[model samples]
Target: MRIVVLAGGIGGARFLRGLKQAAPDAEITVVGNTGDDIHLFGLKVCPDLDTVMYTLGGGIDEEKGWGRTGETWSVKEELAAYGVGPDWFGLGDRDFATHIVRTQMLAAGYPLSAVTEALCARWRPGVRLIPMSDDRVETHVLIDSPDGSGRKAVHFQEYWVRHRASMPAHAVLPVGADRAAPAPGVLEAIGAADVVLFPPSNPVVSIGTILAVPGIREAIADAAVPVVGLSPVVGGAPVRGMADKVLAAVGVESTAAAVARHYGSGLLDGWLVDTADAASAAEVEEAGIRCRAVPLMMTDTDATARMAQEALDLAEEVRA
Candidate 1:
């Protein structure tokens, strides 16, 4: 089967591992969100894409679910020693090599899509991981600073790593989204997919950012295949990450049903909610999409595989 999955960071990467286990022979294409990409120290760091690559390639810190395994921080420490700081975002020594290669290739005039392909050649993530767009589409969060100087926008990483999503966000902006074209294979992957899934990622900033790229949302909406999404919310809280805080920025309630409604039946054909939110299944179904209540926790590989299977099963049910 050909599966195309729209993904974010840690949560999406872990789920992709389970999806691989569930269907080892399946051809998987991951449309990774790049709105979290940041230019630091003259190198571009794509947090979400690198998260997926490292996690799947077995180079990832399984405990942190981001960055490299057996990592070191000499570079960061040295920079801090020099007072060159923004020390909030952690970048390990091993992970720095990735950004180095990516920056080098990009400086040589390669688009991000090509650079990603070259990078993946080394990792062999066992899936085709494509950025949502070659053009820059940075996600910025509008928040009030400590000085109460009214609302100001900061890079997504600053809001996430520094502030830890502590403040209320007035809006999440995907700068350059209006002019950004879908990366070369994104639309094609969606069109040719047997099943398309939105992993239980940060919907507003991750998957939402991917959709914000021109032509992506339209392609998914028009695709003939089933587009299923697993809810990141379980009992009104995110499985991991402060998704509720960002969701509030978009005026969307952090409920399974609300998330389903936010994606809407127009683009999503199926939705999966945790068994804990089974009561909301009826409302989700009434939204003109197939709904299922399943155990959606990713506590371990086995649990995540079951969740992946449930998403695929729901897709098949909806398609039938």
Candidate 2:
């Protein structure tokens, strides 16, 4: 089986782990979100791609669900001591090496996809992990200043990592996405995949950002395979991250049914909601997408694998 997944950071990475366990023989291709990419201290950081790579490669800090395990923060501490900082992002010593390598390769004229491939050569993430676009497409959040001076746009990292997404966002857009193309193999993978999945990642910033790439969404919508999604929102709340805040900015309710509708029946063939939100299933189905309710918690590998199996089952149903 060929599986294509549009992935974000932690949630998406965890789901991919389960998917790998559930379908060990499947050829999985991940289109990682790059909208969260930011340049910090003259280095390029691709958070989503690194999260997925670390998680799959057995280097992830299991508890935090991001960053390398057994990490030290000497570099971060050194930077802090210098008093030159956006100390909000805790880039550790081990993590700095990744940014250094990526930035160096990028300066040498390699596109993001090639750089990612080189990085993955060490991680061996199992799947073919590719960025959504080699071109720069940053996600920026528009928010009112704390002092009420005026509205201004902030990088996604600043808004999320620094402000902790506490500010009410007026809007979120993938800056430069209007001209970005899908990274090499992204569209081809979608075209050849037997199934496409939208993991329970942040809808607005993760999967939404990937879809923001010019032709990626249209390719998935046009693909012959079934396109299915697992809900990140359970009973009117996100399982992780401040997804509700961004969902609200997009004018979508923080509900499973609403999120499914946000993706729309035209793009999604099937949708999965948690058993707790089973009532929302009918509403989602009524939106012209097939919907089912199952246990959506990723409590452990077994539980997450079960969820992955359920998604594949739903894809088969849609195919039938």
Candidate 3:
């Protein structure tokens, strides 16, 4: 089986792990969200791509669900001692190596797709991970200016990581997405996929950003295979991250049925809601999407794998 997954950061990475366990023999192609990419201290940082790589590569900090495990803070301490700003975003010593190598390669004129392939060679993430676009398509959030003035745009990282999503967002924009083309092999993977999946990642910023790329959404919508999604909002709230805040910014309610409708029946053929949200399944199905209520928590590998299996089963049903 050939599976194509549009993934964000932690949630997406964790779900990919389960997907791998559920379909060990399947060929998986991940179209990672690059809208979260940011340049920090002269280094390129692809958070979503690196998160998926680290999680699948066995280097992820299991507790935090992001960053390198057993990581030291010497580099972060040194930078702090220098009185450099932006201390809110932590970058450990081990994680700095990745950014430095990536920045170096990018300076050498390699596109993001090539650089990602080069990085994955060492990690061997067991899937073909491609960025949504080689061109920089940063996710920016529009919020009221600091002193309660007019509106201003801030980088998604600054809004989410620094401000902790406390500031009310008026809009979310994937800057440069209008002109960005899908990364090499992204369209091909979707075109050739037997099944396409949208994991329980941040709908507005992560998977939404990937779909913001010019041809990605159209490719998936027009694909011959079934496209399915697992809800990030389990019980009228996000299971992780401040997805509700962004979802609100996008004018979508924070509910399983609402999210399924946000994706729409035209794009998504099947939807999965948590057992806690069993009642929402009917509403989702009523919207022309095949909805199934199942256990959606990623409490452990076994539980997550079960969710993955359920998703694949729904895909088969949709195909039938």
Predicted candidate 3 versus true structure: per-residue lDDT over 52-169, tens digit per residue? 9999999999999989999999988888899886798878888999999999999999999999999999999999999999999999999999887899999999999999999788
TM-score of 3: 0.99
Best-performing candidate as measured by lDDT: 2
Predictions in order: lDDT: 0.95, 0.96, 0.95
Q: Which ten residues in a row have the lowest lDDT in candidate 1?
A: 142-151
**In the order shown, what is each candidate's alpha-carbon RMSD?**
0.7, 0.6, 0.6
Using alpha carbons, what is the TM-score of model 2? 0.99
Q: TM-score of every model? A: 0.99, 0.99, 0.99
What does candidate 2's lDDT look like per residue over 41-64, in tens digits? Answer: 999999999999999999999999
What clash pairs does model 2 have? Answer: none
Q: Looking at candidate 2, what is the lDDT of residue 271?
A: 96
Candidates 1 and 2, the one with greater lDDT: 2
